[model samples]
Target: MNEPLAERVRPKTLEDYISQHHLVGSKGSLTHQIKKGIIPSLILWGPPGTGKTTLANIIAEESKRPFYVLSAINSGVKDIREVIDKAKQSGGLFTSKNPILFIDEIHRFSKSQQDSLLGAVEKGWVTLIGATTENPSFEVIPALLSRCQVYILNAFDKSDLEALLKRAISKDKWLQSKKIVLKETEALLRLSGGDGRKLLNIFELVINSEASDAVIITDQLVLDKVQKNTVLYDKTGEQHYDIVSAFIKSIRGSDPNAAVYWLARMIEGGEDVKFIARRMLIAASEDIGLANPTALVIANSTFQSVSTIGYPEARIILSQCAIYLATSPKSNASYMAIGKAQQKVKETGDLSVPLPLRNALTKLMKDLGYGKDYQYAHDFTNNFVASEYLPEELSGTSFYVPGNNQRENALKTFLKNRWKEKYDF
Candidate 1:
């Protein structure tokens, strides 16, 4: 008999788990800790199908400790206490090796439910392993979070997904028995959207639909099988990631029409109107920036309007904001500038603040030439003063490069006239 797809592919050990190399890889901190039999309470924060649950199980098995499981969806304070009692019984009050309590969807747990586990975790009655798709800071109570280390799990990359596919095709007894050929993988990857579980499900759907002994899986075959079934937009589910990707790519490609199409898809899928508005707000500052500064204002206003008025009526407001952002002059100069500056800061370590820019509140600081020779721009011609703000090592470093847009062109002209050789196009 063939095993269930989810069970068949469930990673039994950390070595078998895919993705989240930062947490479970050979040299990963968590892997080292688990190998030494010194597991601590930790929160596994990540999107679905990134092996949070599987990793929890592996930790339990490898530790050879008593294991208890609970779901935030069904477990309550009473349930938590019951598990705690069992854990206490398994390992007495002063016992060092306590049972590991694994809670899935722990973000959904209410305050009281989470609080119930805190004492047990603090006292070492159970090593807590909580899995969540939401940010632990936002969802888990501070008291509970304080007792656990939070490990972030990233979405599986293309290579990880491909490795997963290969494993399923070869390792799964059911799949190995069938003659399957992968002609194209574009549609499968598109449909999976970095979700390991979704990828396997789509693979199963394609393989199961084959009529002949020799089955070939291609983009067309995958599309043909799943095309008839409408993929409803799920604001908090897999659809959310897909539509947002489409929306961002459209804006990046400067296709307003495609951008609006994706916007409409999110709205129709029942996405939180405010959530859509927030993404637009970020895109305005990050993607549009000074190219069209007004894009930020429009996006900010749309966010306000959506918060005040929700649903059917707010959709129009969101659509207007999306269209404006999509059609606006696009530049990532400011974004790139900050990113470069941050990278430089990290690479060079901390550098002392230039004397002129330092605070003069203290007498010692003022005596040391702090705030000395500082020229106020307002006192200079054209409200511009040539001065060095960066450290000595980065005195002449240039970061912001103006894009080819009317606003940026005007900025370039102004800077060139003000600083002469200092400003370059």
Candidate 2:
């Protein structure tokens, strides 16, 4: 009765695992590899309760490999070394179905801790499987991430959640004895926020609250029980993402009141202060841009301040920066410029740099026309020259169209004045 229903009903085999059919179905990539008795070092990236840990365990079980578990929240470099030593002792050959090293919340591990596993993972001492809720590109070291296959797990859809519920009711001996009838599931699903573990825990709580053996579950019953038992927000799960998104959007939308409200919600939920500050810094650039250049400076300062000060005092600094950003004139010109430029680069595929723009450090390069006939802006009037700076193939291509804000309008005027007919501004 004390064990969480999520753990008690945890799927031990692939057949019992719900959702992620793309990875575990008959023709799935993972399934194909498993059949051949080879599993690559992998990173399972997805939201909480999306079966990342369970999937990792299943891989180890199905492959008949020794499995090791570590939580980045608690494990350090020494712990990682100890695990790697144990893994090395158990034979370090890939053919013997190398041991699976599964690190839950691998993103939380510091760089040094992550670095400790590099040798083991590279040498086939262990097949590393890392689980992260955050994007691996941002959280994982490039060297480590490059060696692992990244598999994305989606949140359980409505049908999947319903299947999990039905499975629990039919399979669990205690739940079956309770004779629970699910009259409605809207409240249950909504409250769970697509977290299967949270959903099951809520269900179990509802079940325990009922005095009658023939228990009937309804929307109201679930809402009442959960509201009474659960915290307002689970900062580590879906609510964390949802709240942060709302906070960012509020600032982007220029709604100070809404931004502050979400900020307070995050503060109350005990969210990492630096996380909030980092998002604000991004918002300053992506959402505020050149319209308020000072916003970025302030946001960066806020990040530094919060990181140093921390907690109760940091909340004030965070609030001040949030309000300033929300009230500032917003623009995305710089952000859009880079995105458009990248798109053009992708389409063009490494077009040769214009010879005039190329640096000719060697005499051969100079003789071959690199840096030949190059116009030095300082040699001309107004420290400007109207020469083709872009690659020859993209000479007339324009990626940065100035935004409509006053600051960008001034910039447009400046470019038009200097380049004359070259700039279409």
Candidate 3:
């Protein structure tokens, strides 16, 4: 009863686990491996409360291996070494029964800490099962990442959350003593933001606050009971995502005032400085694009500056870049171009490259007429030549259209003069 309801109701076996069917289902990616006890080192990457930690526990339990746990938030190289030494002594190094070391929030580990894991994972001394709420490609070191397979754990859907509530109601003695009826779940589901653990926490809070023995769960009751002040700012929860989204949208909408307000909210909430900078880096190219190519340069510089000078000083750099990006001419032309091009590739499959465009580096390639009749732009007038670069099937196709802005209008003019009516520019 002292423990949190989530821990008490935590899935004990793979059968009891909920959601992530792609990983734990009969034909899931990890199904056969767990069954055979030939588990590989892997990083479970997903959103918070999606059972990444739970999956790691289940894998170790089902495989019947010695399970060791550490948190990246507090553990360091010394802690890692101690755990590895223990695993080797108890489970035997380079054996089939090597221990499983689960590190929660593995993304929080610094490069040196992650480096410490390399030896243990590579030597088969331990099978590292890391749980991260962030992208492993960005947070994990390359050496460690290469040694482990990354499995994605998706967010819990409506049914998954509902099932969790139902299971908790039936399994927990405390909840069973009261006649609790789930009359409505929208508030719980919405408030949890697709997080199964959060859903249970909110459910337990509502149930415990009730004065009567009988409790009927309704949207209004749930919403009213849950603290409305929670929206102030949460760096790891729904508010974290919401605030960042608002910040990005404000920049794209060309409102510096609103953008700075959201940026300040994130800064006050102690958001990772690099995370904020990275999002701006993306927005620079995605929102500003060719309309103002300089925005990307400024955003990139901001990322590097903040990364070096963190927090108190970084806030100044972030504000400067955010305002510059907001005031810049906005355009999603570059973003749309890649999306349209990718769609075309998917639709066309692998179309053959025209012989003229093919590289004729080898003698055999030249014999096959590679690079034949390929127009050299410098050989023609104005250092430009008209030619069909796309596959013959997609002749004259245009994926990029210049945005309606001062810079891009000049591009439109240049392209118009060169292609004439070919691209209908």
Highest TM-score model number: 3
Model 2: lDDT of residue 171: 84
Off by over 4 Å in 3: 92-95, 228-231
TM-score of 3: 0.94
How many clashes does the backbone of model 3 have? 0
> Which tens-of-lDDT digit does each residue in 117-187 have in candidate 2?
88888889999999998889878999899999999999999999999999999888889888778899999
In model 1, the runs with Cα more than 4 Å from the true position are 1-3, 18-22, 45-47, 64-128, 132-150, 154-191, 203-242, 252-256, 272-275, 301-314, 346-348, 360-362, 376-385, 409-418
User: Highest lDDT, which number?
Assistant: 3
Candidate 2: list runs displaced more than 4 Å. 94-96, 346-350, 361-368
Residues 149-169 of candidate 3 have per-residue lDDT tens digits of 999998888899999999999
Shift of residue 203 alpha carbon in model 2, Å: 1.3
Which residue pairs show backbone clashes in model 3? none
User: TM-score-based ranking, best first?
Assistant: 3, 2, 1
Candidate 1 at residue 154, lDDT? 90
lDDT of each: 0.85, 0.90, 0.92
Candidates 2 and 3 compared: the better one by lDDT is 3
What value does the lDDT take at residue 260 in candidate 2? 100
Number of clashes recorded per candidate: 0, 0, 0
